[model samples]
Target chain A: MLLSHPTIGRLVLSAAVTCGLAVPSYAEDILIGVATAQTGGLAPYDQPSLAGFRMAIDELNAKGGLGGKYTAKLAIKDTRTDTAATITAVQELVDAGASIILTPCDADATIAAGQITVAKRIPTLTFCGTAPVLATAVGDNLFGTYPGDNLQATVIADHAYAKGFRKAYLLVSPDSSYTAQLPEYFAEVFKKKGGTILGTGSFTMGQPDFSAIVTAIKALPEQPDLIMTAAYEPDFPAFIQQLRAAGVTTTVYGADAIGTGTVQGLGKLVDGTVYSAAGYPTPGGALEAFNKRFETTTGHAAESAYEANGYEIGLILDAAVKAAGSTDPVKLRDAIAGLDKLPIVTGTITYAGTNGMPVRAVSLIEYKDGKPVFIATQTPAAADVPAPAH
Target chain B: MLLQQVINAISLGGIYALLALGLAIVFSITGLINFAHGELMTLSGYALLAALMMGMPLLPAAVTAVAAGALAAVAMERVAFRPMRGASVTSLLLTSFAVSNLLKVVFQNAISARGKPIAMPDWMAGVVPIGSFTIGVGPLMSIAVSALALLGLELFLRRTVMGAAMRAAAQDFNTLRLVGISANRVIAVAFLLSGVLAGIASLLWIAQRASVDPMMGFVPVLKAFIATVIGGLGSLSGAVAGGMLLGVMEVALQALLPPSLAPYRDALVLSGIIVVLLVRPNGLIPAVDTARS
Candidate 1:
């Protein structure tokens, strides 16, 4: 009404234009709530993904924030790898006015955190909730950026079957949902392919000795052609050492959990062991370039492909935010769902119609000379991929 | 095959015995369980890695690792445990527990929660074969080192003046004090001996794990603590016997249990121990009590 005055309106319009041109700062800020396992058992897995987020956020800011109008700030809270603590952390983040929440990598903790966020209608993204059941369990508010475990299982199963290996002995660790559900998925796919499971072995996480299991495997009348597992870290290395030292030369296969730099530490002990990977650090490629950038920024070579998995999350989210043109959780969730063939550090990811799980290629990598060697990137046919276990 | 399994059991049991004996030494002298004994082992493993990284030769690195444990134990006693001298058994146990968790947190936050790979010697991972039977070198070294450490402890306790003072203190601290032996010195020496034993046990553990993490000491310490309880607390000989028996039980279960029962092997081993404890409450080789008068 005041601007309707002929002289005053012309003067006010000129002043508004002048002020708008005077500052290059953002018009809005987006607070990203990060609840992750920063200091406990899951830290090794979560920290790398956090590093990728940091790198991606830095790049995003460098490019004029979000579409030259908004800047993102991470409000991080440590979950400490406890489910109850995770619940509290997510609530605290939401209460502090976060528009989006990032959860810990493991499914149990992610679900614990997501329940609160989903109730608040906030968008939640898991660092690496590979379990397919997470999509249904947590509803549409949650998104898992990491490749689903079922996809990796199918790829590994198909590859093993192609090698004329019909018999498999599975070593299962009931420690985490990732470790527990992955072997079951493999068995599901492998059995469907007409292969027989020789036997199964179980262990709690971080079992200091695998000699007992090794001995039992040795006593089996017919040795398995290949052994499959999703065990990680110190446990996996210990198992491999004892298994090989006992003269069990069967080929070993694994899920994405085994595709970390930790196996490189085993040197020749892990040679010929093939595992499904979320991404590979290809030479002179985009992933390698990002790795170099990560090294320059953090002063350490990227520890694992998890770093790449995390980088992909950032790129995908940034694209989602741009496509949405707003930071509202609903709009952002919708935008995320509409993403298609988006290139990230790892590879192209498609979330459209994937039901919170991204459809992406799974890399198969082998250890040679104590280093990861990329074999092939596999994308199982939609018909071949087993449905997510309810 | 049976012989090969027996060898495996002995080496695995040897580690338990070595660690249990370390705990026994501290408990005998100070009446404290030294729950941090496991942390001492963890410190030694990290020290060994750090030394090797610094271009030290294998022998010197190992010596440094052992020495690191001794120094940490002595310092821990002087700085943390000494101020509470004559405190109740429960109080000292809690203090040690606090100390153990504190060190593990430091290892988790200040260092890393993830496991760091320990570059092992080739011979440690290698296996020796004899007439269609193959045995791992790690087990053999564990057995040999454990035997040497035990024999050395025996000679020290029976032969040296300081060792005699320690033994006397174990029997009766007041009588040793009446004869002019300083309680602090004797307790410090006991800690030193225990730390050295823990250091050796760390090597055996690292050989099997091939990696070091903040929680690396958890299982070993838990097993050794169980062995101590089964062997009769504060009795060195009992601790060794209990550890050996526990190892043998574990091997037997592993060899006998069906594949379906493999995961329950540890559970069965524990149940068998419970039965043994029921039969012999004071452990297999209970310590003798000396006459006060």
Candidate 2:
């Protein structure tokens, strides 16, 4: 086709000459791709991840790039936190010669990117893609750096059990599958652990009034020991505040969504609330280092799970690229699957074979007088919890 | 459970009523729906939030929010609705929609882009227990505010000369023109009144969810439109009644339905509307006979 078209032929001849002229000075660089939420409701997740990824890449380059032969060149695209945008971002990265792709933000978006990566046989690592369905959905190519939601639920239940909360009041939103599943998962385990569910109340999303639900909880003959809620950050604070206002002083516990900036966004309202988290932000270790480097580069502190996941996934991608030695997708996939003990700021990340799901320790953190304090770390007995019944 | 559902419905209905009242006032006099009504509410909520963030007192913050909403309404009249006076209804509707979109984009950029929960004041954060049921202060505030706004509006229409003139203009602009009252002034008053209603509604809305987003106005606007249609197009009393009825029906249906069928709540509401329209044809209350033919 190039030879048949005169314009193409002339352009190809000129390109070949130009390449030949510059070939001696050209140096090879490993291209790493990032597909993350840059806009939408998930921008809080994606923006920080992008910052963390860049900081990690800059640090690696300062230490003399991956494999000592190639400097890492980061290619980032805004997924807009939508499924279609995520797929497009991955395809664009693959088209632009990315060796490996990084997934950040929502589980659905990450899973969508995983499908593309699997088709292209590229090694893809995600920071916050924790929906259990993604494991069976994307199979081999998808790997999560953060522990899945199952671990989060287990950690919360165990923490409650350890705290001697025998009866728990559960508040779940039926609108969100994420919020709905957490309570369902916790109920099963909490029951197994011998905790009685005192009361269960349902609320639809966007209903600001929780008086009926709160009133219901408050009327329980013997007040529950704890309030286990599965709700988004926006709803979580309001729910917590209302619960406090209703004179139900039962200690409140929440799922991973509460650990996000949405909780921090609550400021003083977030005090005394305990929530499950993947990692902690504190004094000078890996996380602190990551935070310092991230803040230096991005002008903001890494305050949420998405940022931690993104920073850690970048480290994972760097390791896989170093192990693979080349940008070949097949080699990178094999290298990632074979990763035995990759160290991340969050934890010691290890992939569970072709499932590509990370099995890491989950942390329980509480907001004490307006600051997040790490409470305990719990490891799920089983890394892969079966999907809950519909 | 049924009583709780009833309360839920009332709170929701009250919000819908306020939204409808805001939209209906504009429609009644100006004959334009002001598609930006939802944004006006959202902008007010954000203004209150911005004030709170700026360390202003809550009362001042709330006042600023209403003032901001009113100012925005005035701006809308000056920049969008006023210019297109006497144009086709379709053109006016399109202009309102365009203004809504522009405001949404601008607000998203200026504030947190997507929806972020606006924090409630410490005073508005809890529930008041009444007998067996509990209700959030936010919902109570919503119901109280809507009732007061509607009552004040009804009195305004009855007692004030401007309000009387507005009713006259809405009933027959041509006749009012012959009487030497400027049609523009009456229309502008309508917009201002609607803006105040929207501003008040914004406070109630943010109080309920404790959050505000750019597109948050879409659902409220849709509910308001449905309420205004179900109630009569030009009747304020009908709009209030329709909003409360819709809210109560929605919450009651939600309480009655099984978990598996909960997602179909909006569908069930629409189905009920279809049945009602089929029976009434001209809404639950007909427009005042004196207003038109």
All candidates: DockQ: 0.37, 0.28
RMSD of each: 8.6, 6.9
- Model 2, position B69: C-alpha lDDT score: 86
lDDT of 1 by residue, A236-331 (tens): 888887777666678888877766666678787787888987877778887888889899987888888778777777787788788888878788
Candidate 1 lDDT, tens digit per residue, B208-244? 7777777677777788888987888788898898788
Q: Best lDDT goes to which candidate? A: 1
* Candidate number with greatest DockQ: 1
The candidate maximizing TM-score is 1
Interface RMSD of the candidates, in order: 2.1, 3.9
Which pairs of residues collide in model 2?
Answer: A208-B208, B9-B248, B117-B211, B118-B210, B118-B211
TM-score of 1: 0.89
Q: Estimate each model's TM-score.
A: 0.89, 0.85
